[model samples]
Target chain A: MNISHAAKASGLPVKTVRYYADIGLVAPAGRTEAGYRSYDAASVRRLAFIRRAREFGFSIEESRELIGLYQNDARSSADVKKLAAKRLEQIEQKQRELQVLHDELKHLVRACRGDNRPDCPIIDYLG
Target chain B: MNISHAAKASGLPVKTVRYYADIGLVAPAGRTEAGYRSYDAASVRRLAFIRRAREFGFSIEESRELIGLYQNDARSSADVKKLAAKRLEQIEQKQRELQVLHDELKHLVRACRGDNRPDCPIIDYLG
Candidate 1:
């Protein structure tokens, strides 16, 4: 199939398909004589796997590693678990940081007068 | 002061100071006789403000609005409150989205066997 057909089959945008090709993440199985991208069934499966990993909030690099493990029949499940654990740790760290920002911002918003006058604690605190 | 001095005083890297200048978020006060970037105390203050806003997870655009509000003494406190409320809403939305991803990924991780064997449910599900 063509790049468009591959993208459609994989439920990804054409632009994303091109980007994945450009990034060498999930390039087409072959190129046509006319220099157009070609996708075999296996390539489309890889694309779908990438799409699923991305939907689960995996970064490109993480998706690449996961795809690597998927492609290798001899790959251990431990490696995949390690990557997932690392991703979870990162998400947890961000959650903690965002929670701090949310709490502080909520406090400042509560203290602000939010009136027509220029006396706002929010601005003052930020300033 | 030179850009380096201003950056040091503001606790920002010189490259970041140059980036701020390039993006016009916090340009230097003037250019020296040799066309070198020069920063006054006031410009340093704005850079500091931008740095702080970035630390709090504000986008460069949001920091620009905040800096504008900070510079305008006649700005109504209500306007500041509005911006803060908008930011709070965005942060809340992200937190919820991250929470969903976290929960789903955690569930998958828990279901994975993560052993030396190649029979991994995570890869099976993702695939």
Candidate 2:
């Protein structure tokens, strides 16, 4: 199928399809004689898989690694598990950092008087 | 002071100081006759405030709004509270979303056997 058809079937935008191709993330299976990008069913599946990985918050480089693992027939499950573990660890760290920010902001918000006065702890904290 | 001096005093990068000036987020006090960007102490303070705001995960636009409020002496604390509350709500929503992703990924990781076999539940899920 054409790039448009592949994008539609994969539930991704046409621009994203082109970008994946440009970045060598997911190349089309073939190209038409007229020089337009053409994709096979397998290509579309890869595209969909990448989309799912991104939805799971994998960075583009991580998605590329995942794709590599997906394509390697000799790949061990341990490698995949390791990658997922690293991503999970990063997410947990991020959650902790965000929790700190949330607590700090919450405290400042509670201290501020939401009235006609110009005195605001939030502003003072940022300032 | 020069742009470099302002950036050094504010603990921000020189590139970031130039970018803030270009975006009108923080303008220099004046320009030297030689066309160099000149900044005052107040500008350095504002730059520091903006840097702190960004460190709090506020978007550039949000930082701009906060700076505006900071500059306005007659501004009511209610407006600052509203903005901070909105940011807090967004952070909570992001936390929830990240939690969901973390849980889902964790479940998939647990189901996978980290062995030499190519059979991976993580790959199967993405595929």
Candidate 3:
């Protein structure tokens, strides 16, 4: 299949599929006679796997590790679990950071008079 | 002062200051005879405010709006409070999304056997 077809099959954007091909994460299985990129069934399958991993919030580098484990017949399940745990921790860190921002902004929002007056606690704090 | 000095005073990276200047969000106060960017004290203050807003999770476009209100002496406090409320909502939405991802990944991690074996429920689910 062409990049667009592969992207459709994988439920990924065409640009993302092209980026994967360019980055060598999922190179086209072959080139057509006219030099068009073409992917085999296995390449399409790999793209689908990468799509699922990304939807699970894996970064490209982490997805590469998962892809390695996926392809390695003797790979340890422990490695996969570790990777997933790391992603969970990263999500937790982001949530904590966002929570802090949420609370801080909420406080500023509350403190503001929010009327026709030029004076604003939110602007005062930002300044 | 030159862009670097302005950036230092504003606690923003030199590149970021340059970007703001280029985008016309915070244009340089003037240019030196040597054609280097120069910023006045008032411009520096605006840059500092923008930096603080960004740290508070405001996007560049949102920062521009805040800066506009800051420069407008007749600006209503209600506008500033509305912006802050919007930022708070954005942060909350991100927290919810991250929490969902965290829970899903945690579930997958728990289900995995995580042993020397090649079998992985995570991989199976992805597949």
Candidate 4:
């Protein structure tokens, strides 16, 4: 299939499919004589796997590693578990940081009068 | 003051200060005799304000709007409140999305055995 068909089947955007190919994350099977990118069923499968990995918040490089492991029959589950653990740690840290930011912003918003007057504590807080 | 001094005073990185100046988000006071970017106290204050606004999760364009409102004495507090409310809404949306992602990833991680064996549910799930 062509890029559009591959993208549709993989549930990825056209630009993203192109980007993955450009970055060598997931290349098409081959190119047509007219120089358009060509994808086979296997490529579409890999693309869908990458899309799922990305939706799980794995980085591009991590997705590449997961793809490698997914293809290599000898690869161990421990490596995949380690990467998922690392991602879990990152997510937890981000959640904590976001909670702090959310609380501070909430406090500032609560203080602001939001009236027609020019006086705003939210502005003052930022300033 | 030079860019370094401005960055230190505003608690922003040197690259960020230059980027803000280049994008006209926050311009310097003037060019020195050697054509270096010179920042006055007022510019430093504005840079700090922008830094705080960004920490509160405002985009560059939104930060520009907040800066404009901060500078304009005739501006109403209601407009600033509106911007902050929009940001709060965005943060809430992101929080919900992250929660969903976190939960799904946690489930996948939990199902994985993390052992030496090649059989892994995480890989199977992605596949």
> Higher-lDDT candidate among 2 and 3?
2
After superposition on all CA atoms, what RMSD does each candidate show versus the true structure?
Answer: 1.5, 1.6, 2.2, 1.5
Candidate 1, A22-124: lDDT as tens digits = 9999989999899999999999999999999998888999999999999999988888888888889989999999999999998888888888888888777
Q: For all the models shown, what interface RMSD does each have?
A: 1.0, 0.9, 1.3, 0.9
* Candidate 2 residue lDDT tens string, A10-54: 999999999999999999998899999999999999999999999
CA lDDT, every model vs. true structure: 0.90, 0.95, 0.90, 0.93
CAPRI quality of model 2: high
Give the runs in model 2 whose Cα sits over 4 Å from its true position: none
DockQ of each: 0.79, 0.84, 0.75, 0.83
Q: Estimate each model's TM-score.
A: 0.94, 0.94, 0.89, 0.94
Q: Write the per-residue lDDT of candidate 2 for residues B1-127, one digit (tens) a residue.
A: 9998899999999999999999999999999999999999899999999999998899999999999999999999999999899999999999999999999999999999999999999999999
Task: Tell me the tens digit of each residue's lDDT in model 1 across B14-127.
Answer: 999999899999989999899999989899989988888888788999999999989998988888888888889989999999999899889878987888888777898789
Stretches of candidate 1 above 4 Å error?
none
Give the per-residue lDDT of model 4 (tens digit) for B1-127.
Answer: 9999999999999999999999999999999899999999999999999999988889999999999999999988889989998888888888888888888888988999888889999999999
- Candidate 4 chain B: minimum summed lDDT over ten consecutive residues — where? B89-98
Per-residue lDDT for B19-52 in model 3, tens only?
A: 9988999999899899999999999999999999
Poorest 10 consecutive residues of model 4 chain A by lDDT? A101-110
Report how far off residue A85 is in candidate 4 (Å): 1.1
